[model samples]
Target: MLKTAGDRPYRGRLAPTPTGRLHLGHAATFLRAQERCQAADGTLIFRNEDLDPQRCRPEYAQDALDDLRWLGLRWSEGPDCGGPCGPYNQSERQPYYLEAWAKLRDAGVIYPCTRSRRELRERVAAPHEEDEEAEPLYPPEWRPAPGTGQDAQEPGEVNWRFRVPDGERISFEDELAGKQSFTAGQNFGDFLIWRRDGVPAYELSVVVDDLAMAITEVVRGADLIKSTARQLLIYRVLGAELTPRFAHCPLIRDEQGKRLAKRSDALSLRTLRERGLSPRQVQDMAR
Candidate 1:
């Protein structure tokens, strides 16, 4: 877990996506976060990142809570506790995201684009047969004019993107991985802040929620390490406090060294419970 800068009590979070049942991968991260909080006499908040309304289910959210409890993990606050930093669920925190988007707009850091999924995919698939290096190409119009207010355009007409500062390195120290860095304009070009459908994108929403909740540490899977740089830009744009230190735990992988998937039944806590595996056994397996 990321340590606080000083003597301040650490505040960490376990934000689970309720797209499916909690799996072994989920348990491992949750356990780490819980342990970190307990070690610091700190608070661990449970957040439901259930923004994808089409797939997220109330039952799955409840199951997630049950599974965590069954695994002997507890949180200091959640949707049930009415904590100071609530609407613990991302779906319920729309206004917070809207506020963040507005701040980016006011700072001239974001713009609107009109690229479709097919267009983006084709661009990334372009031929590069030569060994000579070439930068990833984004459509010219992808960087929308600042203050265009075109993000208010009709669906499919525009999407919001952050204007990455060219040639700058976005770097941060990870408690587990040590110093890590990425070039802002090289590793990623302008990225979406809002989808064509007007929903705040994950990049923006997660940063906004973390700041609003005053999260002191972000204990998550290593798969999201790349996201830290993007989020740092958001924190910079918003003039929010520096991000909490990050601890990206190793991912849980299958025997083939592939990351666990939603379809991996053997990793599902619910399935393991049905087969009479005790929570202690699951924890041991995760360790």
Candidate 2:
């Protein structure tokens, strides 16, 4: 059986990206997180994932807090309401991510990639437009020899990818999804931990933050199941004693059967509020 933080007092979190307004889907997922935390009589921390320098906006961040509050959800710790686990915002927690990068670097499990997107697409079997969210598998042939990145002092100036142990199966029992498994290189190849723009990627940042906040369970949309597999590797590489369990709620889709995104403004929590939808009504719609 996998060791988990189940024995610890439940520490759940609602980590919302501030690239856009929270949509109905986001609200539903966060509500699930809050519900699970409350069911366990746990502490709920709100993390603002506003690391995207190009897309994240102060207005969007504020709007996420406002919209979630309007939806009648409350968090004990967050960017607004300070708590012991602050600074709750990802933007303020770069030092923590950088520290993790250094640890991974020192462990010699990560390497620098200087290849551009065009170079990758031309070289590797890139995913098509339908799979835009999916990254092309980093070609194993292109990897520098082991110990190539040992001399680098910092992760800036190039993309850094964690070398996945190919052909190894990564399996975990999700509390909600149940009996999940994925192959390493086939499911995903070496993945980005730090981008060339000096920003820590999602895979690395979330793991570091969860460990730091002592998050006992990760509650998020089911769309992130593959991401969970990737993060599990990070946890092991970082020598995390007890990794959080997962509860993946089903994704909310639009009328077209497409998963809701930040672009789904009509179903955004802010728009729903302006349309006079009550908290109960929105919650019902989410259900």
Best by TM-score: 2
Model 1, residue 256: C-alpha shift (Å)? 1.8
Query: What are the clashing pairs of model 2?
Result: none
Give the CA lDDT, 0 to 100, for residue 98 in model 2.
Answer: 87
Instruction: Assess every candidate by TM-score.
Output: 0.90, 0.97
Give candidate 2's total backbone clashes: 0
**Overall lDDT per candidate, in order of appearance:** 0.80, 0.90
Clash totals in order: 0, 0
Residue-level lDDT for 43 in candidate 2? 94
Model 2 ranges with Cα > 4 A deviation: 128-131
lDDT per residue, candidate 2, 171-201, as tens digits? Answer: 9998888989999999889998999999999
